[model samples]
Each structure stands twice: as C-alpha cells, then as structure tokens.
Target: MSNISAAIPPVRWGILATGKIAALFAADLALVEDAELAAVGSRSIESARRFADTHSSGARAYGSYAELAADPDVDVVYVATPHGRHVEDVMTCFEAGKAVLCEKALTLNADDGSTLIEEARHRGVFFAEAMWMRCNPNIRKIQDMVAAGSCGTVGQVRAELGFVAKPDIARLWDPELGASSLLDVGIYPLTFTNLILGEPTHIVAAGIKSDRGIDVSGGATLTYTSGAVASIAWTQMAWSDNRAAVSGDGGRIEIAPRFHETTGFSHARNWELDEFAEPVLGRGYAHEIIEVNECLRAGRTESALLPLDGTLEIMRQIDEIRLQIG
Candidate 1:
C-alpha cells in the first residue's frame, strides 16, 4: 500500500482465480483505502492459501470458486481467469449474489458478453468489465478535450500494439482457448478508437492467421458516421511502436507508445503543442479499483464511464473483424 485515498470505507474483495493477473490486482487492491482482499479462491485449497498469504493476511482461502463466491464476508469478486473460462467463472460469482469486476475482453465472443451483461442486469448486482484504461485520469482529460473540440473536427485516428508471445504461453497461441492477438492485446487500441470516435459505420479488417488458425497479427479500419476514420493494428509475433494518435483539422493528440497504460498524452492546437501528464494511482490499476468501490458504495449496478453497452459493441465489432480475417 502506498498512500491511501481518504474517506472511502473498506469494501471486502474476493479474487476468483490464482493467476498472474490475480496477483497484480491483489497487490494494487491493497493500495486502495476502501479495498480489502478478504478472500482468494483456486482449484486447490493450498494454492489459494499460498496466494492469500502473499497478498492479504487474514484473507480466507477457498478450495473452489463456489466457496469463494459464497464467502459472506466478501463484498465483490474479481474474476481473473483466462478468457476461455470467463463466462463460467463470472456466472459463479453472479449467481452467488456477489458484485463483480471481471478482467477484459470480458468474454470470448459477443454473445457471451451480452449474456454476461444481461445476467448482471437481472441480478441487480454491480458488474463491470475491467477495461482499466477508461479510468485513467489523463485519458479522461483527452476524451474531454476531444469532445470539447480541442482536437478540432477529429478526422482520423491510429493505434498499434504488438508483442512477441513465448511458445510456453499457452493462452496466446491456443485456438481452443480463444487465443488471438486481437483479444489479448488489440482490444486496447480497438477500445481507444471506439471511445474517441464512437461506433463505426463501416469496418474493414484483415488478419494473418497462424498455423493453428488463430490470428497472430491483424489490422482494422473503422469509418464512423461523422466521416472520422480509425486505423488499428496488432501482432503477437514481435513488438512494434505501440503508439496511438487522434488527428483533427486543428491538431492531433499523440499518445505515448504502449498507450493503454500511459500516464499522459500530447495535444497540439493552432500550431502549438502542449503535453499533459496525470500520474495514475498504483501502476494505473488503482483507478479502476476505486471506480468499482465507488459504484458499489453508491448502490449502482452499472458504471457510466465503462458501460456494458460499450463492451458489447466492441465484442460485436471484434466478431465481425475475426470473421473477415478468416
């Protein structure tokens, strides 16, 4: 824990998976003033116990997700399973009456995303896909500026993300597991364009599929109703610039490479450029953790900043892109 955010009462959290992402989130949750890592769950009781001991003292350890979800002390559950198991894992939490903030690319496909959101709505529980970028303060500032026409008449956008996947990374290259560069890394750039430009009127995409048939690299062009267009690309074979930009008639906003977790962006207007940086709380994960806490505290089932509708729309677009690439 670094410095605690003031006045937010503790919200006990149960993590429903013992994975790398689970550990990262558990550490960040400690930085939140209102967050308590109350429980951890894994297929093996010993695994859960080990994770809890490392992340949260006194946190209960459950041998199964069902037990974790049923833990009465837990206020919410964070699903950190791989994409293939998202639906089943999320259902466990939802049906258990626990609020949830599941890791993103919320599900393997659009229908699943819709199904999850519908269930959440029906359950009247606080639910959110952990698309943490939407909660970054500087990203929010750029969004505000773009909406206010700071980047006048935004005409075009571009974003790219790429990284090499080790052969041992089972989830990155396994077709049966819904492995694809688009879902794993491309979602960030796709969501970036979608946030700034809204839904696309026309979407054109292409992919370089691997021997196993999952996309290893790809690109997309999205044209919006306002004539604004976006170009995005991703690859799992090698690292690229990983940069994003939004250009308008007046100027452009340049997001630093690896923009998804970036601290700031540069904007130029009327031939002058200015840089803005808003250092996020705790590796940029605390913002979303706080957002979830706030939503639960306010008795809200949905977040206006990261709405379910948007997640579904992106999943739909992803479906279309994958089909085109195939």
Candidate 2:
C-alpha cells in the first residue's frame, strides 16, 4: 500500500483517445478528488475539442496524441486506444517521461505486453494496467476473506461474462482491431479464476471463432497443483448470467450478476449466509483512478492491487488459450 499524503498535488491525467470507454473514464475522473483531467487527445482536432468541452472545461485538447504526451502539465497518460495500438500509444507516453494507466489485455499478446513493461522500466516511469475489477472494494474484500480462510480451502471456481454485441460494431468484429470475445470479456473470468486458483498446471480450452478468425465464444478448464479446478466461459454472441462463485469444503462465495462491476456478494458456510456490500464510486472506475493517484504521490512505479507481473501472466494465459482455440 502506498502512503498517501494530503500535501501531494492532484495527479494530472491525459486521455489518449475519445472512444466510448475513454469517455466513461473521463467522467469517472471527476469522482476522484486527487485526480484531474488535464488534457484530451484524438486523431481529429474537432473530436478532441468536443471531448474536452464535455468532460473537462479547463482541459486542453490536442489534435495529435504526441501533442498531448508533450504537454508539461500532464503527469500520466491513460492509453485508451484499442488493444492493437497499445504498444505504440504507450510508447509515446513513455517517450515523454509520463506515467501510464493502460486499458486491460495490455496488448494483443504477452510479447507486446512485455515490450511495454520493459520500456516503462527503462524510462523509470510509473505504469499500470487498468484492470479495474481487481481494484474494486468488494472484489478486494473477497480476496482478503478467501486468503484469511473465510472461504476455507478453495477447490473449485466457476465464472462467466458475456453480452450480445451488435454485429455492426467494427471494433468487436474487426480482426485488425484485435477483436475477440476472449480478449474483451473472457479476461474477466480468467482473472477472477486466477485470483482464486493461482497459475494453472494444465489448461484445456475450446471456442467458436467468427468467420473473420476472431473468437466469439469460448470456455476453459484449468487444473491446479492443489487439485483445484476452475471452469470459465465468455461470449459476445449472447447474454450470460455473468455470475461467479468459489466453492470449497468449508463454504462458498457468490458474486452478484455482472461480477466484474458487482458491488456486493454473499458467503455461505455451515448453513448460514452472510451478505457483504461496498460503495462503488462512479461506475467503479474511480477506485483505479484513486489507486493511480496514490501510487504517483508515493513515487511508486506499479500498483500492488494490479501488479505488472500479474498482467503479464494473464497475457501469457490468454496467449495459450488463443493458440489452443485457433
């Protein structure tokens, strides 16, 4: 945990890309007291100005991402571009000596993810993957409880996340954009399972791919050395329950529907059930912003809650899954 001091100035953020996710992140930045949207960047000048006008009246708008990276007032850049462009965009921020909070699935594969991490290390700049679910208060609480034996010797895990994505969405169907149901939604269940089971000793996966050679639905079973097993699934072609559970000999923990952004969960043990709830700020993105702010103030280069090595491991897992399914 970073030692946060009230004396530290607010961390200035630069948004690189005016996409839907980027807009949501910009809105959530207002909920963090120690974070400020200092700039907005887009390929088009008009788009940049529009986003800045809507999200932050005082923020500067840049027609090019390089201009935003070069801004002296910007302390960190949020790489909100598509996963396919992460390596290039993040490198731009690092070149400017600015910290970064990149969107999840850090890149198309672990190799590119490692490349960005190496560059960040060489530049001595703070860098973190924006895996917001790991930073959620309720998720963290569940992790703590499980670690403290509240869940009692976990043995099995099951999780799934899916939604009916429209066919017209280019980013969802375009192979060049790095579109895949696994990369978009499967990552959540995979991360959730890994959090409970650690690294898997054996992985068996199968999936359905689109005609464009992108995975649209998939499932994987992971076996651990502890004899524990996890079954996870994801899809972009249908709406799933989006619930997750961890079961052990002692008890079971049930996360609410849409587990990734869930604000509450329940624990059942010995015929007694207990409910737990936590406050989620601004659609649950504020927690990550708060984390980044704290790390910046404490001069930390990586977030403990969302470690870089963990991100790399998850990327490698995704790589293996892709190879198996492809």
Candidate 3:
C-alpha cells in the first residue's frame, strides 16, 4: 500500500435523506475515528434536525437535499435516497463537486450507472457504489480461499435471501418506486456469484409478479464460460433458509445464514469440516467506510475491488433477468 493510502484525516460526512439506512450509517460512522457526521438532509427541515439531533450532535441539518449537497464543509456525501431517486441525488452530489458513496443498486439500470460513472470521471470526483459486502474482510478471505482452489473446480453455487414482508409496505408493493425484490435484495447474492464465478454467459430468470407489476419473489440461474453454474433467489413474501453454498469435486463451503452481512462460514475438505468467522467491527459497515476513507486519502476516484465495470455488468445481468421474468 502507498503512504497516501492512510485513513482520511478528519473526514466530514454529509447524508442525503434521513431514513432507516441513514440512521444505521450514522451510527456506524461514529465508530470510525477521523470521521464526522457533519450534516444530514431531508425533505423536511424538522426531519433533518431530528435525525441530526439523535444521530449527530452539533451537525448541520438542511431541509432540502440541494442545501446539503452545497455544504462546503462536507468532504463527501452519502446518497441514501429511494432507488427511483438515486440518479438525481447522485447527480446533485456530483454537481456540487462532492465525492459520493451512493447506495446500491447504484441506479435503476445499467445505462444510468454508466452515466453516473461518466460524469464522475469527467469531473475527477471520487465515486463508489456502496456494495458493502465487497469491502468486508471475511468476504475477501472467502474469495481468496476460492481462488486458491479450496473448493476444487467449483461446479455450482447457490444463494437465497427471504423474509415474510407484509404487503402494506409502500416500497415493497409500489411498482413506480422500483419495488422488485430482485433489485432490492437479490443484488447481494448476484454479487456473490459475480465474485465467485465472474460474469455469467447465459441467464434464465422467472418470478412471481405483484398486482402492481413488480417482482415480489424471483429465482435465476447463471451459467459461466467455465461451465460453472450459480442459482440465486430472493423473496419479500416468505421466509427462506437464507444460506449460500458452493460445491466442487474436491470440497464445499457454506456461508452461514444472512450471508449478505459478514457473519461466518463453514468449509469442508476431504470430509473434514472447519468454521471461520471474523471478529465484529461496528456492524460490518465500518470496513466499507474505511475503504472509502482510504481511497479519498489516496486521492483515488474509484475502488479497485468495487469497480464500476463490475457494477455495470451486474446491472446488465439484472436487466436481462428482469426481461426474462417479465
């Protein structure tokens, strides 16, 4: 690592949109040194002030997103808006010449993601898709193990995430808001597949659509050029095993339930089983936060691990999957 890769000095953070994810991010940010919750913006001033007061003391609160974007004190901004508004929100950050860490599925489609990348590059601003899983130490270790041939030729992989979400939730049922479980939850498993199998050569998708013309539950099969296969599934209407497993002729590995978050994993080789789990550090978001801080400190515009190319390819896969299902 270069000397410039040190953690950022006194990084000031501004949050756009005050919601559950925003609150969680603020709480996690507090656990990292040299990082400050400088401001938060919401559609309502009162709401912004409430979030600031509860999550960050003495932090500026703006009633509108544009004001927060224009805050000169903020070194970087985290765009936490709904999926439908990500493009506009991220563009606002870029317009204000602020580095951005936007929430994932970075944009509604692959083309939009490319647009964000183009603008960020044109302006020479730091940008990253908040694919937190890619930044986790445990996930990196797993990737290393797979590359070392621990799983032996890796013939197949499978991942599932699901919960019994009620239909009353607006974002869960509203088609206009990008309410597909495939986009909201399935991205995790799909990303996992991409990490393990690279990009798939062919994809087959089918799912259950809601009355609002949204996919509430879905499953997909991905076949790679190496002849490896991955099966992925997500649902907002039921409970599932929520485990991910990879198998090969030599051995197998199983990530514990709720694999999206860095928990633990089980590995078996030659009928011998072992378990591995990394120590916790601030609900697992701290790692990604640290990665961003290091990138900014090094004056880098994009992360090598979470590059835009991978994000765009995943999006293309998403588009293809949705097309097949529809």
What are the models' TM-scores?
Answer: 0.96, 0.97, 0.96
Residue-wise C-alpha lDDT for candidate 1, range 18-82, written one tens digit per residue? 98888888888999877889999999999999999999878999999999999989999999988
In candidate 2, where is summed lDDT lowest over 10 consecutive residues? 1-10
Residue 267 CA error for candidate 2 (Å)? 0.4
| Tens-place lDDT digits, model 2, residues 235-273 | 999999999999998899999899999999999999999
Give the lowest summed-lDDT range of ten residues in model 1. Answer: 1-10
lDDT of 3 by residue, 62-178 (tens): 999999999999999999887778999999999999999998889888999999999999999999998888987778888989999999999999999998877577666787776
Error of 2 at 228 (Å): 0.7
C-alpha lDDT of candidate 2 relative to the true structure: 0.93
lDDT of 3: 0.88
How many steric clashes between backbone atoms does each model show? 0, 0, 0
* Clash-forming residue pairs, model 2: none
CA lDDT, every prediction? 0.91, 0.93, 0.88
Clashes of 1: 0
Q: Give the top-scoring candidate (TM-score).
A: 2
Return the top candidate by lDDT.
Answer: 2
